[model samples]
Target: MPNMLLGAFPIGTKSGANNSTSNNKNGKCKFLLLCGGYILFLILGAAMFSAIEAPKIDAISKRVQSFRKQFLQSNACLNDEDLEEFLKAVITANDRGISPLRNATNEMNWSFGQAFFFSSTVITTIGYGRVTPLSQTGKIFCIIYAAIGIPLTLVLLSAMVERLLVPARWLLGTFNSKLGHLYQPFNIRLLHLSAIVFIVITLFFAIPTAVFAYIEPTWGALDAFYYCFISLTTIGLGDYIPGDGVSVDNRSMYKIFISGYLICGLIAMMFMLTIFYDIPQLNLGQLFTESTNGETEKLHLSSNNTTCYSGPSGLYMPQRDEDTRRAIVRIRPHGDDSPSPDEAPSSLNSGIRVP
Candidate 1:
């Protein structure tokens, strides 16, 4: 037998101290580069976002300023400072989904349906920041509620992901059977993931996009698709919401259904992520982490006349050369004539040497 194990083993201490030190240095360098790259990525995202969004922010600021000036002009008695304070309060209220104007026709934000939507979003970590607790009591309750509910939501979603994985694995198996000989396993797995992606996009994204675009007055195709992606990814930008318009019929039902859609869509998103993470080669964590020693201390003993039996390794076991019948051996004390089925065999004759 060889002194080392091979075939897909981790980094072992087979090399010298110099090689280990070099590998440690390389790992440190890789880690530092990863940190630098991540910071650069963040900066890049910030720069691009500023470039793309600054114009819209300026336009909104201008519109709000114009509205403020117009309001002051119409209400001649109200001074600029007074209107500013009033507008601040109105903005605060609006931030919490409380409309200051009397033109509102929808149900109150705390109504059962809206509250249900808020709770679901909160637990799922998809908080849109659109509706929020105004009172200290409600805020405290929200903290407590989230503390208890988030884990429950994760447990529920994780169960769904696990159940979904069975079918996903089965699909991968089917793909392997059909194309295993023609393509590599990685390629076949990619094809399986692609098929699942297509199905998820069709059912959760494409169909919902069409439905939402049809029903939502302001949403175009791009907006609907964008909303689905953002919400399912738990981004929850709060820029747009379905079934929020005053003209929406049966708005409560709509909100409830939208909440359900968000939950289901989130599950589908998690399922895809699970599939992606299942592919070890695609995992990025391995790039950032270093392996420890994986070698085991092995001892082997052999003698010419002694029989030997090697134990099992995984599914592979040493085959038996001969079969031994399983027969019960019973022993009792010499003075005991009655049958003693519970007596151990060692009581009659001590251990026997095989060699």
Candidate 2:
């Protein structure tokens, strides 16, 4: 009779054990494929970027070499030794406002206006490095300033982003009201993200690129766009800066205005990134985590009871009241009629007992 009962109730095998294993394997495969596809996309992007930029870089190099050859040939007085001496003089003259030539007015570097711009850049973590603090005292002050400034800047930007999210959420809600019935939530999210991206590109990138190209004679539209991208991304490659190559009458004011532009652009970028990360479907961080049985875990809450599940998946699954009660009853002692204070209420209608 015991053998028959044992045979009737299976002990080792589960109902959906094979299906669960298969789903996990499929999820892992999908994750790997997603990763591989992303890697390939990056590789292709890099290749295309190199293909477009390489010729321009090569042309610039050739022009530089040609200019150097002509300069050396044209100047009968400047031999290799004289060139070395001239470069040394130029280096020494840097930040000192002294001209390497016989008679020239000192460049107004480290002026109050320029210093203010530099401080703004440092606080924003832009650090273009085109103009840097040279003196020991200045360096020490910069260290102290940045130590205090970085966090303050972050707090300010975060507050600004939080405020901006009101309009952003309004736009999302509008999109949902118009299209939610027709499309999935993920599609609506993408549409919202695309709209934000459009706004950012139009305001920060396209208009700025046009303005920069118009103001800076040496910078074409592409160069201006590249500069904007680098600066907004905080890459600060320092290869291209505004109001630096040209001799503008109000250089200090130009620097101050550009500083304001950088700050605004950074704020817009931060807001866009915050919105992007809020969408779970697009978050890349999930790739590194373990996969579950093909279903994404969702949370459910009740007024009186709470239950959670855990496994290799690192996902949170909700349990029904009946399931919760059964689990608790199965685990508790057979004679124990009442649950302990730590135990969650069996049903949403039941009141949670206090100790």
* TM-score, per-candidate, Cα-based: 0.75, 0.68
lDDT of 1 by residue, 44-136 (tens): 999999999999999999998999889889999999888779879999877766677676655778888889889989999989888988899
RMSD of model 1, in Å? 9.5
Q: For this target, which candidate reaches the highest lDDT against the unseen true structure?
A: 2
Which residue segments of model 1 deviate by more than 4 Å? 1-17, 74-77, 100-103, 290-355
lDDT of 2 by residue, 128-147 (tens): 88787777998999999999
Model 2, position 108: C-alpha lDDT score:
58
Clashes of 2: 0
Candidate 1, 230: how far from true, in Å? 1.4
Residue 138 lDDT, candidate 1, scale 0-100: 96
- Report how far residue 22 has shifted in candidate 1, in Å: 3.1
